[model samples]
Target: MHQQDNGKAETFDVAVIGAGVVGCAIARTYALAGARVVMLEKAADILDGASKGNSAILHTGFDAPPGSVEAACVTAGYREYLEIREKLGLPVMRTGALVIAWTEEQEAILPDLIAQAHANGVTDVEMLSREDTLRREPGLAPSLRASFRVPGEFIIDPWSAPLAYLGQAMAHGAELRRSCKVLGGDFGGTHWDLKLSDGSVRAGLVINAAGLYGDDVDLALIGRRDFTVRPRKGQFVVFDKSAAALAGHILLPVPTKITKGIVVCPTAYGNLLVGPTAEDQTEKDVADLVPDTLAALRARGEEILPGLKDHDVTAIYAGLRPATEEKDYRIRHHADQNYVTVGGIRSTGLTSALGTASYVFGLTEQTGFHYDPPESVHWPTVRNISEAQQRDWERPGNGGVVCQCELVTRREIESALEGPLAARSLAGLKRRTRVTMGRCQGFHCTARLAEMTEGHFAVPMAEATGHD
Candidate 1:
């Protein structure tokens, strides 16, 4: 990995802006293809943006617009994730999703959605009768309606997946710069000089995978943009672990053109999740939780699974998606300038990231830039934080537990704080080790964590609380 020095401009073959999941995957792809790659993130840590909060479902693209880039990428990325997840120690909860139609009108749309699923190459989707739906999920409210089962859809560890992707990229000689913002750039025909917040770097090609700020990055570097980023905020509510048993499958509502609607699914971390009330907002960064919205979400969750009323609420959070006026993804390649813009990737980004990287790599190749992929690739396995597998606390020599609620160990926390992609803040550490994210929400572990993470975070623990 190349370190930035103030004395001179560092050089690389590729500079991928934004360290979101898509950017991480793009960096990995270029690095594996034998390009010297550098990934930049404006946040204190990777995934501190839109990538941080999500439903964590690995979609089958069953309901995605057929023949669209989103569908193709989701299909390819889904296949690739299943093919490589075991090697990376990524957890997959094979809880197939059920798209239930509560209303008669929604039931009328099931056949068309099933046809769309088949058109998208997911032929295993089968329509289920009301009896079959109730049998599959006994805890679901006895709503007199039918549903379709998308067997390929499953839940995955969202944070660990990208961390593993970037980790493998670093292992294969990719450099990551967190807290580094790309202020502007100059493309000089043969190469590009990117001006960052800290210093400057030169690269032969630049790929804009900046999720929410994608348009801004394109405008800054190329002085033009085809699409404007319209931020759409989605808030969610997480139930306690006990509620996870209520939903055997990912309970999904029939998707609308605007959003996928609310999803009541089980997280890989052994908690039931219901969320994502879609609200269009002008604010790009702050996705504040609304009391009334969350209350409505809780009520909707109870309506889906009547058993949820008995469970306590664990947490509530919100995420912003880089939505645009158009439904399709905004991807364009400028061969003359040696640039590619990947924008307008919304909710399905987690599942489509890898395939998007592959597509973007092909676009980069169109500019006459190519490299021989490494003969042998390094596959780095991330630490298991999901309930689908044995956690560090369950193993011997774990150095004792730190967060009792999540069973996070001292050793695990230390490891997360000591790596190349180390946790630089409380949020980063939580994403890495699941600390302070359980039922107690760090009530019992904050003091201990503060002692352990002192002087490590950019903002000290005493100064910052929930902001990180």
Candidate 2:
């Protein structure tokens, strides 16, 4: 968090651009290796980009093409996620995936998918009969021909992962700068001089995990384009928690080469999620919820879960993935420039974040950076406090309740505001404390949260409400 003053430049051993899940994980990895690391984020908070919105399904790499970086990283990352779940209090659900075959053509693809799963080191995948599939998922279409079950796939709280990693990194002396966009940077023979929005940063080495705008940063820094990041917009609809039972697993349609297809899955927070209509967008196309698309998704959901027709829609939003021309991830080390570009992460970025960070570290090590092991560090546990724990904090003035729908208390929201990775806006607070993100979607709690934030942080109402 140190900024240069009096024309004296502050330097670091490693500077990671983009505070997404991957970037935060890279920062934490570098910090654990005892490097003086600094994470620069363009947004006001972490997970504000593609990392903020996703299907939240931690892939098993079973369907991934073998021998690719994604395949390898996803396999390793799922294991890392299991370990991470033990340390952090984030909601990590081990809900396995069910790839349903509604048509004979889809049924025919199941064996090949099983083969791919085996090739990707996922041996627990099984093809189930239509009767067994119906037995497992009663709400599924009776037209089910067959299904492939992958037991390792899971769902997670996407926001909590990066926040926990960043919190731990910050606690271990890795600096984080919010709203600090890297406009450009120059690499000398021995170091890099980055021109941030506010000021300049000098670093011995740099890692670019700048998700969607990754290509822009790569071209600006390395002076070449190995790939271009085309934003693939995925629109999703979340049903009320009462309809969570519609899909007991990550119910997916058989994959097409173009997309994973629409999926009906349950969130770790007890809600059914559907759609994610994969419509690739041009550079100028913004990520917005298409009502027609949402309607189509709802219709598809009804086909997958007949009960969905009765359930209420809770939320609708869209996220853009940094899709590239290359089938695999575009991770390369510029040894001479003392830089590594981590780009084209796409859908599996969150699932493979830890493995990707480890790979980036290995690349940095190959470039001559070394790590000295630390004994221990404080890893912050950031998640929803239980009702019992909430009661404990009620005696203090911070215990007043706020979001009745989500049961968020004033104490929890304030903690998010005061934490190391403090919320800078309503959206930030929503990700941090789950306030105003429930069924009401801030209809009841936004004004209260905004007022408290404005008064406490001394910010204007617009800024507090995340209007700008």
Q: Please provide, for model 1 over 1-468, each residue's C-alpha lDDT reduced to its tens digit, 9 standing for 90 to 100.
A: 244545588888999998989999999889989998999889889998889988999999998899999998999999999999999999999999999999999999999999999999999998999999999999988984999999989999999999999999999988889889999999888888999999889898999999899999999999988899999999999999999989889999988989999999999888999988889988888898899999999999999999999999998889999998898888889888988999999999999999999999887787688887789999889999999999898899999999998899999999999978999999999999999888888889999999999989989899895753
Clash pairs, candidate 1, are: none
Q: Tell me the whole-model lDDT of each prediction, alpha carbons only.
A: 0.91, 0.82
**lDDT for position 425 in model 1:** 94
Residue 418's lDDT in candidate 1:
92
What are the C-alpha RMSDs, in order, of all predicted structures?
Answer: 1.5, 2.7
Candidate 2 per-residue lDDT, tens place, 231-281, comes to 889999989888987777999888877688898998766678897888887
Off by over 4 Å in 2: 1-7, 385-398, 455-459, 463-468
**Global lDDT of model 1:** 0.91
